[model samples]
Target: MAIESVVVRQRVEDLDAAVPFYERLTGSTASRFAFAGVTLASVGPFLLFSGPDEAVRRVAGVAATLAVGDLDAAVEDAVAGGAEVVAPSAPTPNGHRAVLRHPHGGVYEYVGP
Candidate 1:
């Protein structure tokens, strides 16, 4: 597997407000998606969030995103390793991705380019 390392992710309290700020910062529009009552914005490989306090508390920071060539395979591996598919694989405005919660509570996004 070619693990290209973590790309980008940011934890925020309000996704509604955060997206606009990030859009301006990146000088690009956000590709938005809803997961776990939180909104996610993708600007290139950066996965930024604005959502529930609980979700933010759990992640507590920028959750690492692994850029995998095949998102399905990475998700399968995560599941086999006792990770739960917090967000199933799907096509977003940015690309394709799936969110997993590791057995130890760390959240990760396996993303495809």
Candidate 2:
């Protein structure tokens, strides 16, 4: 599996309020999107999110967002290594994503074309 990039996950009360700070800090413009009732912004190496409590709770525990080379292969390898599937591979506004918990208990969100 090829790990292309890693994005730190951050939750906020409002995406509009949070994106500008990250943009200024990272010196990069934020790319915005919406998924499953939550708003998301990708700024440099940070992925900022905001939504209702229940919506946020649904995605809790994901340590970070990983950009991978191949979603299918990544999922296969993760499962082989004892990573339990939290959410199956599915399409996202940005691309494809899958959630899994590593053997050591860290949950991760993997994204790929």
Candidate 3:
């Protein structure tokens, strides 16, 4: 599958307070959305997330959201490449997503249309 954008994830205590910095840094206004219980904002390729500690902790320090052409195919590729699936693929505001932990222990959220 062809990889699209890689979105960096940032977990913050307050979405409102955290957005301005990203906006300034990327020189782009953030587009807002809510997924599950978390509030999200996209500024350039950065995805800022804020929500309850329990939910945030699940994705804390996640390297990046890999955008792909097909979610199922990406999940299959990840498993074949020795990545452990943390969460099965599911629908998201943008499209679909799944979480995986690489063999080296790097966790990432993969998103696809």
Candidate 4:
């Protein structure tokens, strides 16, 4: 079966602080979505957050993982966007992956096939 899409949700303490960094990493501006006092940023295949909610915080960890067409480019872009590489890009048990930390303590994983 074909996987249509994937989305990972993260809870944030402040939405505004998270947007620009994500926008830079994804190389696309976030499409904002709000409901029930929750704000979300749709960055390509992942959905990220910024707003207060205890339950969301408890459930959120390693917020999203992006499957990219080019690992090298993604890594370079992430670095240029001010993301700190938590894990350098390398082949994993599953595939190639690299971890990056956003300015606001959110984590993202970039994987390539």
lDDT of 4 by residue, 1-113 (tens): 12224467656677788778778877888888653355677776557766566535533555677777777787787778788998889875446877789777888777786
Report lDDT (Cα) of residue 55, candidate 1: 64
| All candidates in order of TM-score, best leading | 2, 3, 1, 4
Please give the distance, in angstroms, between residue 66's alpha carbon in candidate 3 and its true position after superposition.
Answer: 0.9
Q: What's the TM for model 1? A: 0.56
Using lDDT as the measure, the top candidate is 2
Better of 2 and 3 by lDDT: 2
lDDT of 1 by residue, 1-113 (tens): 46776768777667777778777887888787766556777766567777668865544443787788888888888799899998799885557878888899888767795
lDDT of 3: 0.86
For each candidate in the order shown, give its overall lDDT on alpha carbons: 0.74, 0.90, 0.86, 0.69
Clashes of 4: 0
Model 3 Cα shift for residue 24 (angstroms) = 2.3
**Candidate 4, TM-score vs. the true structure?**
0.47
Which pairs of residues clash in candidate 4, taking residues 3 or more apart in a chain or in different chains? Answer: none
Clashes of each: 1, 0, 0, 0
Per residue, candidate 2 scores C-alpha lDDT tens digits across 42-89 of 999998888898888766568999999999999999999899999999
The 10-residue segment of model 1 with minimum total lDDT is: 54-63
My TM-score estimates for the predictions, one after another, are 0.56, 0.93, 0.85, 0.47
Tens digit per residue, CA lDDT, model 3, 6-100: 98888878889999999999999999998767788999988899988877766665789888888899889889989999989988778888999
RMSD of 4: 11.4
Candidate 1 has an lDDT of 0.74
